[model samples]
Target: MDIKIYVCHHKEGPFFENEFFKPIQVGRAIAKKQLGGMIGDDTGENISEKNDNWCELTAIYWIWKNTNHDFVGINHYRRYLNFAENSQNSTISLDKNIDFLLYCSQNIVNICRSYDIITSPLCKIHQISSPNNRQTAYENYSFNHFESDMKLVFSIIKEKHPEYYEASQISSGLDICFFGNMMLMRRDIFNKYCNFVFSVLFTLENIIDTSKYDYYQRRVYGFIAERLSNIFVLKQQLLGGDKKAYHAGQISLPTFTRTYDFSELNTKLGFVNHPAQTAIEILHGGTVHLVISFDDAYMLHAIACIMSILDRASVRDALTFHVIHDESLGSPNISIIKRIFINAKIHFYDVRNDRFPGLLPRNRPHISKNTYYRLIMQDYLPREVSRIIYSDLDTIFLDDIIQLWNISMDNAILAGCLDEGGLTQSRKLFGKTHNKNYINAGVLLFDIQAAKAKYGNLRFLYAESLAKHVRNITLQDQDLLNISFVDDIIHLPLRWNVGSRIYGNNELDYAYSEADEKIAAENPAVIHFTGENKPWHADSTHPLKSIYLHYQERASQALQHAQR
Candidate 1:
């Protein structure tokens, strides 16, 4: 069987290609450069100019009209359908080892022979959102997108393709969905699908006024097509006849990260490229880097936290620990740290405490001046360290830190779990004008390079912002961060950073559904001891304190053996 899987690209970057897997530039009619050795969607009956609104559909359309292959499929430059035996068909993975993740022409042909259509696996809506609301596809779509456009689509589907109207309605009310407009099927089936999807989308294009939509919302057709593809498949399955319309196989879409090599910067020009970054000693592939800051008081807590992470790490997992502190962490403590983490890669950064003098929050003893150390990470971390996971010393790890590291930053400066009390705190500090959902600064994934580019010197930016709202800054750096990078932060699931405050608090400033809190509490990756009740303290009452004590005892035992 002849198969051609067109990998779509908008700009030149790292891409995988083969005889069966070819590269094609989408929206070439409006693009500036013609990437070499690749076909363009602009040729032969195309809507390349509408690529902004249509997205990858421009490439799908180009294949339908231009190609005559037996089996046709489409994939993005970074994302691909994983048919590899090692994939196990359950989890999404990054293509760190290209050979293992990808399949050759003969391999793909052999696999697809058993299936009629291959696409992404089905996703449950409840898992992604609050189960209390029990959001349906239509309700979910309306919440995120323009409701009027979806309503218009319903009318059009009912009038034009009445055969699929019931399937569409059924899909809209169900919690399951097949996302990402990607699939491989027979030529005839492909054409029929293209006909059905494009007919509804082109009609939608004619009726809706996308001129007023924002840059992101303008890609309305692509969003709707994701759902329509689900409906199209459901309609085929529901067909009541002796012959089944189509047999579909759903595969997991594994997104590959663009790997970087900073080993070359180990030469004399180490400080040349990234001026804000510190010296690069040793950075390598498949390593998860974590950065933390604390003073002498929290040294034990930091040790316990680090032990928790190293305790759960797999043998294959390589972890690099970066500790940021001032002269307060004496030479003896540093020596103890070196011995405890002897098997692991670790680095120590010393910054003067006097750097942040009067900027410290008043009447807040629990919040130390060392809390501001995270702000200067862009100026402290190595150039090779583009991304780093930052955590407060008052927390312990329960699951793999690699899971937190692998999350796509999506070009955001930082990603963390939302703080339910953040909005009310921000309103008190910076007035009601600051309304964006606030994230707890306890556990954070920082795209350090992007942060450096966004704010030249983050410490300077914090100091500058602090001068204006000095009196109002009660929560110290947390308040400052929420105000500074308010629009630039992404809110991840609560499971990643489960705070103890969420266990009993009811008057939340921002609403995180009870169902979400319950899920996070049950299976947490990082348990943060927020508020004054710390596990180490005598009066503390946190229920998860026993887990912390378990790690603390082990950490102490490790420290004692290291002293010998």
Candidate 2:
């Protein structure tokens, strides 16, 4: 059988396409720019303008009107049906290797011989219902959504197709549902399903007043279609006696999108508007880009961190510093930095307070919103630049950063040393089944080209993944980074980022052994003040406080000389 499955996307991002799987842009009518080579749903006969409420249905409608194939399927950009026999029951797992999980057209054709329709496994309605509630489809819909709108849908179905109204009633009474609107079936069956789904949704759209609804609730028609899909399936089951019976098969797939509560946030970040400015430019060989984010409060520490790099780096290595900071980092500080690093290229990005209007409630007291500055680099940095080394302001360099930068990425998105907390923190963020070694986000070597190709819009990816976890964020951006790039990070040696946590605790909680940890601690390449006990604080008990103080004196002398 000739089969084609369209993966629907809202924005441009990393995607996979084969002969059997193609990319389609949803909401293209309202999108600012069309994704390069993907087909837009706005072409041909489409209700593309109503995508906000229709959701992915707009793609289905376009396919129904424009394309003709033996079998057709609809999947999301980040979610797809797993056709492999060995992992049929796995859902919500990371799509580390999506290609392996997907089967070819011949395999799908073989499976279709026994089943008429292929889709996600049916989930209990209460599993997604409002809190403390276990209700049937109708009751759950009314609780979570506008009750009147749902009732209106049922009435429209009763008036338009009375036979299916009985099926709708039967479906509403049951506690099972088909979420996400993903499906694959014969052309005939698909035509019938789309006709039924859009008919009811169009009628509801005309009668309902959704102007007062919030952005989420405005997507009412899409939510209604999920329940209607259940009605269509139940109706098919009821009519089987007169026909060759339709057999629906289930395949569990990972879903990347989830709903997040942004009530605590003042304003959500939209798109990148401003680009970073280079304060001073220098040209040299083996140039390495180093990025660090901080506020005025960390000026002394940030200066010491940068000086340590200059002090220890080889003359053969060229350096470029990208400083992302808030408004408080005044011109005096900028002048001082330029005077001190005369041979290096200095780029400054002055972020407004409004850029980060709100912070996550679970963020630790020591960690601030400044940590999120690294996430916005994807939008503002020059495309020509392919790599960056991001470090925290609370760190001191013991070895040349160019050495860390020169190491092979080996196809990983970023490379970093194992976190001091080891798998204990990993188990807390993800479940105990997590196998990937969690790396400290403080010191990382980012492969910019590969990461942008793999996951577009780093800030958006971080925001979406952060909402999926239920744990209290011990490290705000660090938690989000691990969640986003769980399996795509490379583990560097312990010497790269030896944390203060190891020096303070009697029982070391590091991923490396005691012997390895001691060796790295004694002659560390970079010392990270991981916890609250920082070297700058008067009462800090960090064993490496003296080393930091030595750099602090050097940084102070450089600042004074620049004043001259």
Candidate 3:
């Protein structure tokens, strides 16, 4: 029983190379041509260019369409199936060691002799609010626009492969399904699964509006495919005998880290004081503290968001900005941010070396890990700070900051504009009907002391929840915040955070109507570019695109002046 597992990689990394495993580069056709000889090509009989949409599954397609092996398997660049004894619960973190490779090369074939297919541990999506009513795997996908897509998938299956439709439906409702899309199976089973998944995904490609989705959400097809793999297995079991599969435990390894490495800076930079220990010497009686989180890549956007705040804020001089960032952000970017708001007290918090663990998850390529920074703000902000406004990098302030700061929390822990999209999808996501008002995390006014009192040691609680229920956290920090503070939330007015989704024809179900749209346009206190089309992108259709550019241009000029 010789097993060949192809480990997929997009960029160079310290992947293990041995007789059992081969490193294959996915999306090689559209990738830089210079990498032809250096990386494995996924061009012939492949969907290489759609890496953004297909993710690691493109490599799976390559393996199925091109490869000839007795037994085959697929794993990601960072994630792999752990085959070590008693290691079923833990993933093999491969560093500079080849022991993991040796163990897999030796044991994989033996394990396959007993099990027809080997898959990663089942991730169970349980009920969020009620213990009696647990959510199904189908319900989980439904939350992210997959409900309609799966309906189409089931219809196709029912029309074509009627025999498998009943089993597929049963599997869909079963909350436990193989996750990570990493599996080891015999060539025949692998071929069947591949044929089913790719066919369905290709059909979806032709039918679904891929162009309307943002870069992150466009990967819906891949997500659907992940669930389908389990459905395929379930179908086989229903037809064949039971116990045809084995659940193998896997581990997550840190594939890469982004670090600031600019050699031109004159000052030696390091982590400053801890948020808990840092004294609030700069705080005045009525000073408005604002917090924003982003990585170096989004420095320009963060600058624009801050600039917009400064431009419209009546209490400009009284505003103090706290930037939560990674160390990879160069000194030049930090200097430029300070230059943009020279009048405001700009403090930087480098979370690179912070002790908080598991706050960051396996984020999509587009989402920065810095997003998790907001969850740990309770531990990082000065104790003197009673209340603060936290905003996302994509937000632009359209009205005075004082208005947002003055909204009474009314005994609530936090206040934010209700998420129009979240409200519509609340039942599917949270399983609650009475509280349809889910506030967006993009723009929030945190009542610091109240929030701390409600959720004690937020960093610890967040880290614990993130580690245990990461799969449950579909929307990342937004989902975590909503789930954690579901009851103690105050819904602000829609105009406070008018998102771009409200205007487009592919608008969410809960989008503002024409009357509300006009009101938002006339009195939008904050404009959020929530969809895939951002103001920075060339194809941006945001009504307030010019405003973002206006601030961006000024930010660029300010940076140029600092450089000169």
What are the runs in model 1 whose C-alpha is more than 4 Å off? 85-89, 100-107, 110-112, 126-134, 241-564
Candidate 2 segments whose C-alpha is farther than 4 A from its true place: 1-285, 353-362, 506-508
State model 3's lDDT.
0.71
Q: For model 3, how does the per-residue alpha-carbon lDDT over 1-564 read when each residue is reduced to its tens digit?
A: 567788877775566667677778877767764343234645568777888788888888888888888889888766678776676544455553446666645456667887788888776665443233356888867755547778988887787667678777888888777776888888998998888888777877888786866544677877888778888888776655464787776755653422222221111111122122212223325788888887778877887788777766665667888888777787777887777667779898877787553436544557767777788776777889878889998987777776777777898887887675665445435432325567788999888788778777776666665665555555678767776677878877778887766544332345335566556655677888886678899988665577678778877887678667
lDDT (C-alpha, whole model) for all candidates: 0.73, 0.72, 0.71
Two-way lDDT contest, 1 vs 3, winner: 1
Per-prediction TM-score = 0.51, 0.49, 0.52
Q: Considering lDDT, where higher is better, how would the candidates rank from best to worst?
A: 1, 2, 3
Tens digits of per-residue lDDT for model 2 on 374-401? 7777665667767888999888877767
* Candidates, ranked, TM-score: 3, 1, 2
Span of 10 residues, lowest total lDDT, candidate 1: 241-250
